[model samples]
Target: MWKIGNIYFIAAVAVIGGALFGFDISSMSAIISTQPYLCQFNQRGHDENGLCLGPTDDVQGGITAAMPGGSWLGALVSGIVSDAFGRKTSIQLGAIIWIIGSVVVCASVNIPMLAIGRVINGFSVGICSAQVPVYISEISPPSKRGRLIGFQQWAITWGILIMFFICYGSSFIPGTAAFRLPWGLQAVPAVLLFLGLVFLPESPRWLAKKDRWEQAVEVLTLIHGKGDPNSPWVIRELSEIREVVEFERANADVSYFELFTPGMINRTQVGVFTQIWSQLTGMNVMMYYITYVFTMAGLSEPGTNAVLLPSGIQFVINVVMTVPALLWMDRWGRRPTLLVGAFLMCFWLCINAGLFAVYGRAPYPGEFTSTAESMAVEGPPAKAIIAATYLFVASFAPTWGPVSWTYPPELFPLRLRGKAVALCTSANWAFNFALAYFVPAAFANITWRVYLIFATFCAAMFLHVFFMFPETANKPLEEIEEMFDDTKPGAIKYIGTPAWKTKNTRNLALRQERNETLSSEEKMGVSGEHKESAA
Candidate 1:
């Protein structure tokens, strides 16, 4: 509730930038197969029903892939902007860029214009996508971090659900305005994001990193203790942060290469691969091309309403399950949630592929006809395939969808958090780029077998998590640094027993020092600063 903490309001509003991010993602899906979309670019041999009579797979891929491409660049460079101008200001900068891109997309008259606009808008998302999680994570307390950080993904899904409905409604209008109107609506979120950040405080950790200690302390008190500068909890947080930031400053530099150093490599691997697994879950096949998937589902008329069913199912399930994810993450722990999700996703993908392998038919090329009405194997087979797709969505929505975005930021130390996030996010968009570029051609060429490949990847991801990932459920952020400093093999799984988890010799010494300082402060009758208490 807004009454509980200002960080909730700040984080909730700041991440509307993610709404524009989600808007661009699903917007093109609505228009791509529409008559106006295909005809506007002058596909010389394209039929009126939206299928190209000539080779246009690559063109379609370019239109869809441009945003991820732009996102890649924006993510790589976002850390520079975020570090130079604080997190709030960086988000504002990204919103301005998003609005510019939305204008270009709304006014697009051809395929090139459309692609260019998507890329530009995508660049803005890249910046937001990279920074939003980091910003949310920084302002949030260790106790409520999961719920707060997860809000960015929730905002993204809300944007997606809204845009999908908008597309369904706009399909009634005859002509390009149907798509143009929706494209321009993105400005609503983008502008709202810009205006909102003007009031939000900068990320306190970033202020601490910049050595603006007074501002950092002030912001931390405001968010964590309702503006009580002398709150004992705030003092403990400041001391804990000082330890981590001081260590990071002495040893770390903000660079892509720094992510791979021996001390930080584990964090880097977890961060990067978490993102890769998020992409390989095969979620995008449905996300960006549900219309195509439905058209092939043997429906007589794959109208907007018909297609809307699957997209709507996905959005609704995504919104519904996100709440449980926030609740379960802190209690059930990260590794359990992710591994179960991976296993279930693999199960669903196999079912999806098997149904298609036996009962489904590849879509007819060169004719966007309602041929499914006359096809031999209709009815249950198509419905079964749709069911399998929804099952996959159910498995993913509660788990990988939010975990991927939330977990990676927690992996990095605060000093290099911005760049580290950007690095992993680029890895995410990189795989997304590959999938978007190849999925169309794969559908045209291989059909149902594509699910088999993703299923295999899902299995591999499950194994990777079992071996590589650790359980960091309720531990303080500073304690996470000590966990990674441990070099023993399979060291992460040693949750309650290991030196890192047990508050080993080094931590024991720190505790003793904290007690001595607290004793001295108590004697002086001044409690403005307090030492961190043992967990």
Candidate 2:
């Protein structure tokens, strides 16, 4: 592929931050099914054999719930930091916390220590999740914005694939130390990311917003490649930045509460709820409990190669699908790809759930007749069910997977974008925590029913996108803002009101008068400053 620009190299650095974000997510899942971790609380737990557990259920549940609960705080606090500091600083802080969390996890001797460490790691991920995408989005050209942000999703999948193999590989090593080593392996990326970020620049757009124009120019020049700092490309982007900043300045200040103001409320609602809907899709439930799902599919043991194989392969699939997502996002248009992805997920999830339900309710032909005959049934439908489950994984890899991370940042106005993105991300982590903590219980009660619930959510998401979501594909940020402005009832009401009519008439005459002084080049979309007066 042709090198797009220095931004592509910058994207490479940005993706490492994303890799750490992804690594943290899939790291815990790797050891979730291992010994000591899985069987630690089992009362009558068996060692490497069909084991029984003590109050393993209650104790582990409490511990697991604590971890994601901490994650919730991590995600919530990330917004404040990202807004107060900058995305780059916040992400760097996240790396420090991640390293600390990893060390804590590696050395943990008790449940509280483990929980605290998980909380720290969770916090790091929360910040990385929000900041990495924003940083990538700010630095990216609009033509490649979708794909650039899409890289974050891809990195996450790669992390999952790596951890899955690490777990799979370690499972054969024959001791508690074996599994513990894999958990410690997460520290590698944390260290690499920390080192990498030191050499990277902050987002030029973000710097410009803070009125650090000179710094913004330097960063933009480096990101556009070692070009003359005053070149046309550099000049063009700086001009865009000035226009955007001026536009935002004249527009009303958008505070958190102002997020609910009449003219701005719809964007806020979409920004917040789209995140809520992403979680309701039940993606996390599967991600968090894939091991347990594997167990139920007849693994019968945690330390087996077979169990780890799927885990690794799932990760590989996630990474593979991500490439296509970035390629197709702009070409396909946002709404269609997203909606189609959702619907495909719904179909796959429903089929998986139904197959599992059938297997649970009735045995198949010629299978182990003992358990089947005891209940006048047949054999375990492990193969069919596991196949369907993996298919569901593939379904999520390209569709809801990338959209969940990309959509919020894409949809909001720049003024409210940070807080709105933060809130939506918080909602996502909240659901992520809930799903991670509760999936085991959900499975114990009715595995198939749990999936059915997710399938229903996916179907609903598909409909919601069809009716409500707009096509933001390949549109400049300015045009997207105007589109959302048109969606607001009060915006329309403001335009139609008598007060608005006078302002509109006055503004029109003012625009015509101003246009009379423009240079010829300026009239042709070059060499003139542009500004939007609306906040």
Candidate 3:
């Protein structure tokens, strides 16, 4: 049977998994303020103006958070499933789960049912989010690996932009269909992903680990050699993979406990913290609840296009800004991109917070606790806050957004790659669940102070990236392991080490020299065999 062997096509298909994540993000953000959504899910009844109100800030937060809660559990188990079944099958299972979860969410009749459905959907997202990057990284060539893995983030932004518009359009429908329509449509990308997986190749590294050497070489040849099994590039890559796999099989037992040994712990910390700080950047708060941020910025009319339209622009910016990362992350490298992004994100958040503090006030006079109260910051300062929010998204979309997904999966050894990435991705979902649940109440009581907290987080992450994270661009997966094999006990060991330098390309030169020697030997052997046959 014919299957896709082209790297770019495979990446496009795999990243639909990331798009499923995008769909869930804006699925609620776009429709949460519509009357159909509030009337059906908000148990607190209507206000004096006949508009519906939520039962409380906590209830609403829970409804928003239910998916990520399920996602955290899903991420935890994804490693086990991917390791046992292979990367392609694991993603296919996630797509199936997402379709079922979408049905439950679309048909939900109450808050509990709604939350239950979101959790199920979250579980599917968890599996996809954890494994998709691993699958892509394994299949991609080192020189283009960052860009290909970056396609996952670009897909996510496209998913957000597309789903937000879908929900925005549905909001005009007069009843439960407003929310139900978009929820039902969430299954479309999952359906496409599952079907697409039918024609995609499994991870070559997974094949190598399973001792399917012939199949692994075939896949590597197809992906990197354009069908030439004897191509020098293919031979070198296969040789490198076999060497690492054999060494790992002889030296180590694969287990979750392996992630924390003294030698492995630094790589593990870098992997896990890369994800944790991505969430700590508080970008999802923008994706998941842009409506609330706009409301606080004085675009307070909940169900109107005015509020929804501004958010659509933010989503567009997210999609557009991500393109540069996909094109240039290898050139820019991971460490500097992350450092610059963290500082810029901190700057934008501080600007937003300051604007709100100076010019904003609470809409209700007494103690604030629910969506019933709105922030009364208006006029030019409100516009500035909105502008700053846009700038924040711009900084994040290009830098941390794609790098977060690309960095972790490439950090660990082949034996530990799946589980290590799963743990790292779970950290992301864990924080995602917390912020999704907490932000509504934060908006009600603390208001602009939330931005200040995230700004501080960004500042801390800037230092973290500078001091701890090493450069990992333009090097083969096997070569990346060398950066973390230090005898020193702490990350400070990387401060002036060879691994810290962004321009390190010594490994590439060594690999090229090895490939040349092997090619010359092959030519000589073929000539000698012809002479023997003639004799």
Among these predictions, the greatest lDDT belongs to: 3
- True-vs-predicted CA distance for residue 453, candidate 2, Å: 0.6
The CA lDDT at 129 in model 3 is 94
Higher-ranked by TM-score: 2 or 3: 3
Model 2 worst lDDT window (10 residues): 368-377
lDDT of each: 0.75, 0.65, 0.87
**Model 3: residue 410 alpha-carbon error in angstroms:** 1.1
| Candidate 2, 181-259: lDDT as tens digits | 7668888887777776777778777787788898889886776524456554566668867876777778667577777
The residue-by-residue lDDT of candidate 3 on 292-339, one tens digit each, is: 778767775644556788888999999999999998888888998899
How many pairs of residues in model 3 come into backbone collision? 0
Encode model 1's per-residue lDDT on 59-100: one tens digit a residue.
778788888888888888888888888888888999999999
Q: RMSD of model 3, in Å?
A: 3.8
lDDT score, residue 485, model 3? 59
Measured against the true structure, the TM-scores of the candidates, in listed sequence, are: 0.88, 0.82, 0.93
Which regions in candidate 3 have their CA more than 4 angstroms from the true location? 302-305, 364-374, 486-499, 502-535
Lowest summed lDDT across 10 adjacent residues in model 1 is found at: 368-377
Query: Of models 2 and 3, which has the larger lDDT?
Result: 3
In model 3, what lDDT does residue 210 have?
97
